[model samples]
Target chain A: MTTTLALLVDLAAIVLLIAGISMFRAPQRARLGNLVAALALTVAVVLVLRRHNVTGLPLVLTGVAAGTILGWIVAVRVTMIQIPAMIAFQHGAGGVAAFLIAFVELTRSAGALTPVTRFSGILGLAIGAATFSASMVASGKLAAKLRSAPVSLRFHNGWLWLCAAFIVGAGIALLLEPASGAPAYAAGIIIVAAAAGILFSIRVGGADMPVLISFLNATAGLAAAFCGVTLENRLLIAFGAVVAASGSVLTLVMCRAMNRDLLKVFAGFTPAAAPAGAAPEHHEPKSPGVPPEDPFLAAVDALKEAESVIIVPGYGMALAKAQFKVVELAGLLERQGKQVRFAIHPVAGRMPGHMHVLLAEADLDYEQIFDMADINGDFASTDAVLVVGACDVVNPAAMTVEGCPISGMPILLAHEAKRVIVCNLDSRPGYSGVENPLYESEKAVLLWGDASDSVSQLVTRVGGEA
Target chain B: MLDLAIMLAVLVCSFIIGYLLISRVPPLLHTPLMSMTNAVSAVTVIGALLLFAVETTGLEKALGVFALITATFNLVGGFTITDRMLRLFRSDEHHQ
Candidate 1:
């Protein structure tokens, strides 16, 4: 194929990819967008296979077949809650491909490589290996295979910098020498960068995970782009750079939603644990007169009377796996002629847009869900607020408390409702470790137990009322 | 040098376009958006395939196999899963 033709083909594939992303502007068009993007990739891969005088065709086919079956099986079978871990694992897989390809190109050839190629090769090696290890950590945390909280080692940032210095030194040595044992230097840099990635990721935990995961997504793309530079493939470079851009946009959006500093989180700053015995001991919400009896009965009464209801969900609801019951409860309320809606905080679940996926899995209508920005105002006028296994996003302390970890974070303003019923595990502070003033509000009713049971109770009781 | 310049231009243009396009995606689709991009970056499978085009050492071939497998896995899994997630987001209007 002529160079011009190859370039045109590559450009067409890229434009298709961009078109796919553009259709994501609306959920209705987004699936078609996904299919278009897949087609673009399929075209790129087929083009490469056709253009190259590819030897070892059987071996390549075997590899492709193996990968396809594995990927398709997992994608088909894995549940919504597993998506975060699965996505993180795929990021690691991308990393593995990038570094291995870069490593092969760098080490398999003699000293005839151009400086730019050599530099990008080294970058691909370091970034890909690092992204691989860091993504493993993120996936484990997301999957509950590892500690979900930040695991801060002593001198974490110091060790990270030491690894960085070692990679730079090894990088310079490889760039300058081009001698025997260059492969050794390349391997050393990969190892150090891999360790640095773990150190970088371990300090980030809880609500910061979405940011960390997407940033790894960005780095994985960067490594692929560098590998493309090593191979001088413009199509590969364009694809990698586009993915990097998408990841960066998501990372920035997640950080902005949380009102957190990206640099500070990356700098190994886990918030210090709260002091002993100073948390919300008296936060037992003063539920409006219940005749000193059942809070469940009282909460049920509040739900029955409300004309407009907004349900607020957090990570806790996901943990309890109560989305189905919650959805049923929403249906019951809507049946009672109550206008029901879901208010989702951007940073609500383990990943960006996770709660939406979860609620969608429960067959809840997308129209009933509202982003925090869109629905925060409705909470004030809504006749009732049903908070199921959520705390900090609804915690008034983000707005009222000073100098806490989540002090300045924007919240759902669930406390603004005339009557609030909390179906939670306990009145303990959320991931932020800040006392929830919402719990102490006179209008709030706390149903302290598992949310699935509480929501089911409401569903059954509301069924009777219906 | 011209090849290098062209490659850089491609990279920068794609980045600018991707950033602009992705920033417009609603938070409703961010998860699928991310997974789709993850699949796209696996375009490094091109680099991996090129390794097999030339005569290669055993170590290089082994690395090629690993790269080919993993990159394909990421690419396929990402797109397929993104499809599944985005399918869940369709409103009743589509079915009608």
Candidate 2:
């Protein structure tokens, strides 16, 4: 009962701390706070066990503290973008931890090991090890260290059968002799399984890792839940369930975002390679019709002529840290008797609603921002479309290219605007690694520069501060 | 049990909200956000590792060692990649 009480207090304190910290920092700093909160909560849980005089309490605390400090040291020193890979790494750790716990539980329960025990343990072990390998490859792919490509065997279905035979044989042997004490065989099985995971993950490149990562995360959670059931631990059961459900949902959403059926992706499906005679249905940019007018003067002209101007914020806006500047520009534009609204695209950044959060940080009014469907129609009627650091999403190719990776993806049809002013740093293509034909479109005028500087200039031009 | 249910519900809801919000965010923030979340997850592993290490039971001791290994991977692997990514921007002289 004392242990329980300690856990309860720890849980409460940790929760309060995490919530409090989130209110202060952006996502980057919030993560650090989260780690601290987790450690505190663990201490609380450990305190509960201490009251029971649990013999392993000290060892446990030491392990947890060392691991946490190591993780913290790495996290603080690392760059912001590697967070996803970091997340994957954590998931991998969780998977291994869960696997080990389950293995220990199985051995403890069945001193001589029943077939059922061995089977279940081996299954969990295989999945956990495989998940670890898959996630590691995913991290590498995200980090761009290893090439992401599916390895295909020429002329033989035999290797796959051989792999299957080895796995099944190992399972049978382990089940037959649950107390085999043969770490070599067990190690070999896990190694082979991990190799399979690595090969499979590397094979499917160009697809996002979120889905695979989510799936792996779910596997890890399930392993933990399985351990909880084995050990009759309620807390582990609860936490594991939460992780599993959340991971599954995330996987589903990622699949939907990419417009691929989850099953097809799992089956290693790719749209048939572009067929011969398929003249890529490309849009030729309208002749660099007339070079764009000076954006500085245009900003003044826009405020003078327009009663309402909408500012569409995209990923480029975030990359340039121009949210604050955009806000200032909006304020100036409003002062000059014009209204400003931000057009937000779904999938604007790498994650969802990324632009909205950045804008919110800049203290922009949420209601003033509009979705793509709601604001796309207004482009033709509006005075100008000030596109900052956006390319592929605003391109028309997404709708036209049938089998292209982002072909079926929904995008804002900014090319339909009357006067399109694009704020891009250069002529580089987007995530798809293809040139954007939108830049060459007739209605488009590329105002090349950094997002923040360009927006600041626009603001200064409007406020006559320049 | 009730507390567990509540926690589960909160996690699910937060994940959904985060997932939806992901689409609207800029790609540049994705790595940063991911790195941060990774750190959050690592804490749990750390806690597990600490709990496992001093366990009197053979089972608990084994579990602790397992947790330590996993947590180490997450900490080292994640931070190393993140640092490399951040280096890309740091080398740029004009990055704000």
Candidate 3:
């Protein structure tokens, strides 16, 4: 009877995991899926604990209660704009957990651990340590606590390889001589792995953060799976494998969207030169003497005459907290019998689908939002393109600039519209540091202000006219 | 050795299945997808709990407790955040 009950619980856990995976694939079912996953996970944990006949139930419950409270507070209090950072923190927490579990296991029975378990334990510790530290850096960058620019030491790549070699050597020594101060060796491995994580993440600039976060998440999952191996926990193996695979796929998808080589990203290579055909001199300033047009009046005029408008939102919009005002302007235009739609770049905001969340928060019609592939063909016939706090995604440099970091990457064809009105705080280059040629086009006018304030001004003027 | 092989097989198979499934998720749902995965990875708590169940030194027990705390934090935080984010995307039909 006991065996039967355990089997049933295991079956239920697998079913729940499968359900959670399937639900995540479809947006319409994601909410219910999260709930189901949470429930299923809770049940599984309880069953596992009961089957194991853990003695310290009170202690376990206390730890869980405290953690759940902390997690709940963070999840509930964090704004949509901070979701990326929150995810980073969660990944960090998971990493720390995996590392601790493996550390305890190794310390408890280093001599008894089979060679395979020892090897897997070392792998788990190294990965978990790296994920923890790297994710902390990612969280700090996303939260603006650290500079978003890439930070690198001299010969950082060499340092990374050296660190890897050191860990491998130490791991082998631990396996061969398990009794000779194993704890000290494990601690050394953790420290070196943490340094590697820092070195790896600090060299990546803010622009590539989404991919970095996903990649680190996959590493964390792999570490947990290794922990499962060390403990012979089937559920841990299943969950970890699923996350590792999903996270890696997401990383690849993000990299593909930007036309970036995954290997280059891992090697921390930044493209520093303009493409050969593009006018290198014209990169920064096409005409310094020509001040941008009176942005407010220009935007108002364009909206007045436009029959259709496409709004391109980027990280700047998120920084300015301007999605609501942007939606207001869209609604105003829609009321004027003009068709207004959002053109979403795959990597538009700090995280994937950031713009969609902001716009969705404002209760915009879902039909009005279109991804790059879905709406790229509509730009040519559009009456006006409103570039809202977006720079590199709509920059024409991607097309004409060769050898540029973002060259050949797909971008919204904002220049093809009858008129382009850009709303940004300044003419400074975007995260890639490549100057945007679209800003200098004859048909483009720059609106200078915080995105929210400028959009609010446009809404007032447009509403008055209506 | 046999158990290790079975575990490896499960890991590899589940990873492939996960990759195929997650690839189908629309870009619109990427954020929620990430958060959901975060929640699922919290399964490490099971390992921690099992560790504490067996006889262990004081240091091991302490480490197990710490692991339990962190894993639970990720599991609870990840799910709640995903659910909160997904709530924003629900259509008007569901809101009423």
- The number of the candidate with the highest lDDT is 1
lDDT of 1 by residue, A311-421 (tens): 998888898899999999998889889999999988888888888899988988888889888998778899899998888788787788787888788889888899999
Worst ten-residue run, lDDT, model 3 chain A? A281-290
* Candidate 3 Cα misplacement greater than 4 A, ranges: A1-11, A269-293, B93-96
On a 0 to 100 scale, what is the lDDT of residue A199 in model 3? Answer: 95
Summarize candidate 3's per-residue lDDT along A1-466 as a digit string, tens digits. Answer: 2355654566678678778778865567888888887877887787776667787778878988888898888889998888888899889998999989888877777766788888899999999999999999999999999997888789998999999999999898888888878888888999999999999999888888878988977988999999988887777887898899988988988898889978777676564644567664434433322454566787789899999999999988989999999999998899999999999999888777778888888878766889899999999999999988898899888899887888888999998999988888677777777878777677887786698998999999999977
Q: Give candidate 1's whole-model lDDT.
A: 0.86
Query: Where does candidate 2 chain B have its weakest 10-residue lDDT segment?
Result: B86-95
Task: Report the TM-score of chain B alone for all candidates.
Answer: 0.93, 0.60, 0.90
Please give the DockQ score of every candidate, comma-separated: 0.82, 0.15, 0.72
Error of 1 at A461 (Å): 1.4
What is candidate 2's lDDT per residue for A1-466, written digit by digit as tens? 3255645664554454335224223333433443553454355355445544445545655665666577667666644444445566677776666556545544444554445445655766666677778878776765556664444444223554565577788777666655655354566667877776665566554344556766766666555544544443344443444445545655665666556666556545343344456444432222345554564564456445666676766667766878789888887777766767777665554333356556655766555677776777877677767778777677677787665656776677666666566777766665554456677766565667788987877776767642
lDDT of 3 at A157: 86
Give the lDDT of residue A441 in candidate 1: 76
What local lDDT does model 1 show for residue A127? 97
Model 1, which residues run further than 4 Å from truth? A272-292
Who is ahead in TM-score, 2 or 3?
A: 3
